[model samples]
Every structure is written in C-alpha cells, then in structure tokens.
Target: MLVEIPIIQKMVLYFGNPSLTFSIILFSILLSSGLGSLISGNKYVKRFTDNSYYYLLFTAITILIIGFSLNKIIEITNDYVMMQKMVIGFLIILPMGILMGIPFPTGISKLKNIYKEEDILPLMWGANGIFSVIGSLLAVALSIKFGFNSTIYIGAMIYLFLLFYIGVFL
Candidate 1:
C-alpha cells in the first residue's frame, strides 16, 4: 500500500475527490489486520469448524491475491473512483493481517489451554514480538529479490508451509 500510494496519487489527482485511493488502501490495510484478530480468535474458531487449523493457510492465500492483483488494481483505477477499489482490496488483505494478529493473542489462548496459566501469556507475547521483528527483516530482504508481487506470493507460501508444519506436528 505504501508504494502504491504515490502511484495512486499520480494516477491523476482529481479535486474534491473524496476517495483517496492510497488512503483507502492504507486504511483498509490497518482495518483488515485488526479484523483478522477477531476473525482468528477462539470464539470464531469454536463457531467455525477447521478455521483455527488454517492460520498460515489463510495468510498465504491472502498475500498471494494481493501480490498478483496489486498492479492490476493500480492500472485500472480512475482517480475519483479509485478509493472504492482500494477499500475493496482491504477485504482481500484483511485476512492476511488478521491471521497474522491471531497468533499474538491466540497463541496465548492455546498455551493457556494446554498449560492453564495466565502468567505465561506475557512471556509468550514478548517472544512473539521478537520473532515478528526478525521475520519482518527477512520479509524486507525477500521483497528486494522477488519484487512486491512475488514477495507477497512467497510470504503466502511460507505462511502456508508453517501451517503445514503445525498441522503435521502439533
């Protein structure tokens, strides 16, 4: 969304165009991630069968869609109406961020389910933060090699692989 912002602005900035394409995309990016948390929580898990089992699965697929369609979205969007499409893309990227957010809280939930302890949640969160930082660094490096499209695809693939690992082992 960041890279797409200026491109979107340059796509012909129309006056009084309430729909800022780049802004919509950025907002959607945030909104999607926040929603992913609730979507990936235990409440939804119990209500929806096999949902909990596909954390990495959803993340992978979502990222891939974002990768392949991003350029298309940019090229096709008109200045004034572009915001709408950008917002719609939120629906696509939401699962990616939301699913990513899931582990932050859900991991605590799962750990508590197994160990029945509250104190461990903090420790788990700290560890989760550290690894997130590390993973982000790796993502940046990968993005340089693959470009945005393949980067998203590869991220999705790796996320799906993590799911496979969890499914197979734990």
Candidate 2:
C-alpha cells in the first residue's frame, strides 16, 4: 500500500538499503505516534470557537490537503533518504498527527458532557482497536486486489469518509 511513498523507496533507491528504509519508516511511525499522544488531551484549544466547527474545519482541510499531497509529495521527494527521510516524514506527519489527535480529547469532552460514568472508556477504546484492525485488514485486502499504487488511492478515499463523517457531521 505504499507505492506512493517516496521517502522510503527513495531510501531504498538511493542507498539501496532495505533495512535502512524499514528503520526510517518505523522511526517515522513511532515519532508520529508519540507526537499524537502528546496532544491527546488538548482538544479544548478550540474553545475559542463558539462550537466545534473550527476544529472540524481544520481537520477537514488538513486531511484533504494531506490526502491530495500524498501522491505529489512522493513525486517531489523521490530522492531523499537517511536524515533527509527522517526530516521529511516529521515535517509531513507532525502537524497531521497533532490535529488527528485532537479528536481523542474532544471525544473525552463529549463523553464527559453526555455520559455520567467512566466505564465507557474501555468499551470505546476496545471498539477503536477493532476499527483499527478492520482498517488494516481493508488495506491488505485492497492491496491484494489492486496492488499498491491503487491501494494508496483507496486509502485516500477512506480518509474522505472520515472527512464526511467528522468534518460534516460534527
């Protein structure tokens, strides 16, 4: 599903080291996940808005831009690796990861306001786990059926569903 991922392949292409490419990718993912967790409790930053519209708007725009740029970013950065790949991945995913994290805290706010108990967190987290597994399964299925290039496009389409649900419905 990573036919559109340049930095990794570029690492492989330039240095021709698969291990380095894999390490670069894992580093990026770990860093982004850490960055995501760091801001997980700060969603109320949008309280300046009268409602959640501003946050939702930002999320939609960010996701849309990221989705569109996924291909072009790969194209443009088709010659980076090692430290270059590390910098590129952080530059790309840092803001996206932060904004994507806002929903978790915002969700906590919503749950607190709507419900009166604490037991729901476990169930909600469990459901999230299931959703993630399903998402991975879908990615594998798409890659199997259409190969990697089309799978990246399919992932973009999947992000649009998130935009529709959270961006519009929120």
Candidate 3:
C-alpha cells in the first residue's frame, strides 16, 4: 500500500494517466513476487532462510534504499517516454517485490520445521490477507493526510519495527 501508492502517484505524474502505469506496476510486482515464491523452495533460498535475520535485514535495507531513491529515479527518467518509464518502474520495484515474496512461504516453511502442522500455513496466509486489506486502507488514509513521501517514510519505519520485532522475538 505504502510503496504502491507513491509509485503509482509518481507514475501518474510522469505518464499523465493511471491505467497503464498501474497495470504495469501491479503486474510487475505480482509476477516477480510469484517468481520469488516459486523460487523460495530452492536450496539456496532455503539456506538464506536459515539466516532469516540477515535476510530480513537485507530486505529492510533494500526497502529503505528504494524509498529514498524512488523520487530521484523518477527525476532521472523524466525525459524518457511512457514505455521507458514503465520499464524503469518495473525494474525499480522488481527487487523489493521478490524480497516481499520471501517472508510468507519462508515463515511457513520454518514453522513447518518446528510445528509439524499443515493448518498453520493457511492460517498465516489468512492473517496476511486481512492485514493487507487493512494496510492498504491505512496507507491511502496516511497518504492523503501526510502526503506520499511521509507515507513512504512511515512504511520504512514500519519495516524497521518489523526488523526490531524479528530481532527480539524470532
């Protein structure tokens, strides 16, 4: 929600419309994340999951980098055509999309290792869906109230808090 709103807004500013840019952003994220989810079962990804702390740390850092760099990237690409801007947006989001894909399956996989239970995966996904809906609403409200940049900062802070939560509890 946080990241999507700002990126969409920026894309609108660049391209003068929402439909194509939104489709590109949404599809790019979905496709890349689906790829990430599929790759999560790979041996290397499993090895990375073993050190989930560092994985999440890198995720946080990458998100922060994206949040900070997105505006600058838009500025740099200002003269490019709409198609080029779309591609740039996709490339900008692809890494984070892949990283965002990791947590759920990896979390469920880790839990399976410890709990010998199958039901938890569905429960985890359900909880994620609920929070995602709520988070999207909240992100729009925050964006309207505080502006997009602030919303992105708040999103980064939320990720930082998650990092702290993982450090303390996971």
Cα lDDT of model 3 by residue, 1-170, tens digit: 67667767767787667787788889888987887898898999878867867787777787788888888998888999877887888898889889888776787777788779556777777888998898888888998898887887787777778778978997
The residue-by-residue lDDT of candidate 1 on 1-170, one tens digit each, is: 22233223333233134365446555755675566566665665535424545545665666676667756665565443545654555554565556555555566566888777446777777887787677666666655665555555666677777778778887
TM-score of each: 0.68, 0.66, 0.89
Which candidate has the top score in TM-score?
3
Comparing 1 and 2 by TM-score, which wins?
1
Candidate 1, residue 114: lDDT? 79
**Distance from true position, residue 75, model 1, in Å?**
1.5
Per-model RMSD to reference? 5.2, 4.4, 1.8
The TM-score of predicted model 1 comes to 0.68
Question: Clash number for every model?
Answer: 2, 0, 0
lDDT of 1 at 50: 42
Candidates 2 and 3 compared: the better one by lDDT is: 3
C-alpha positional error of residue 110 in candidate 2 after TM-score superposition, expressed in Å? 2.4
